[model samples]
Target: MFFDGTLWRDDAMIREGLGQTTGARMGHMSMCGREGSIAAHQFVLGRKVYIHMNNTNPVLRGCMPDQVGAWVINRHYYQHSIPMTDAAYMSRVGDPALRRT
Candidate 1:
């Protein structure tokens, strides 16, 4: 699936201090560099969302639009449950400093 000198990422090689690699051989993931590189300031905030997904993954895609909506609601409900569980644990905590936390 590779051709000589074609689709060569010269910038990546230069960034990695690797002169220039060409032809047939593919570069390793270590040399692939980071994804979504952007500067962050107070007014210009940026972050990375780490999610494990695959092209062939059948999650919610098989479901209807109504089913997807229901799934989202359920997901949100479950996410909110974490705070309730934490509050319940804090209520049962005998330590004042921990409770204050």
Candidate 2:
């Protein structure tokens, strides 16, 4: 699920750009212009739980956390899986060049 105003909002847009009807599933995805966008948070959490549950990696690695207090204080689910920094998580997932080796 992509947030409004993000580069690619949904699978239809992605499919149109790539000109393909079928492809790998982009589970629990989001892109926001600013940090802690509420829309982004909602999109990630509101989607089917199974998508996130099945993936081994941190689903919200690149996305920002909700409002400072709300994220931690309210006890939103999957809080533990959020990455400290996008760079660190991306590295752990492996660089594209490294993966090609």
Candidate 3:
């Protein structure tokens, strides 16, 4: 699973993972988004695995979460967007309606 740690409380995690060596934080939608897309492509093509994104992740920028998730699914890769607020409900209840995408 890929965790978008951009908004994590710890700067060290972001710095080491998403920041440049100069300590510059990368753009969430531009840098990390592309990384996530590439990862999706690789995993879907190479390992034939599914990829799920947390609702908090800003991977697709302006696109609606459900639309992107549907597109990913169409490509034979599973991409589900789970909202942070309803994450507990999903994990415990497994409600299909709670899924955003």
For all predictions, the C-alpha RMSD in Å is 18.5, 13.5, 11.9
TM-score of each: 0.38, 0.19, 0.22
Point to the candidate with the largest lDDT.
1
The per-candidate count of clashes, in order, stands at 0, 0, 0
lDDT for 69 (candidate 1) = 70
Please write out the lDDT profile of model 2 over residues 10-95, one tens digit for every residue: 34335445534322244333332343234436545545222222112233335456633333453344444465464466677657
Against the reference, the lDDT scores of all candidates come to 0.42, 0.38, 0.41
Write down the RMSD of candidate 1 (Cα, Å).
18.5
Where does model 1 exceed 4 Å of error? 1-57
Model 1 Cα lDDT, one tens digit per residue, 1-101:
11112122325444445545531244322212242112112234444321221112233347678966765675577567889999998999998998997
10 residues in a row with least lDDT, candidate 3:
22-31
What residue pairs clash in candidate 2, if any at all?
none
User: Candidate 3 at residue 90, lDDT?
Assistant: 61
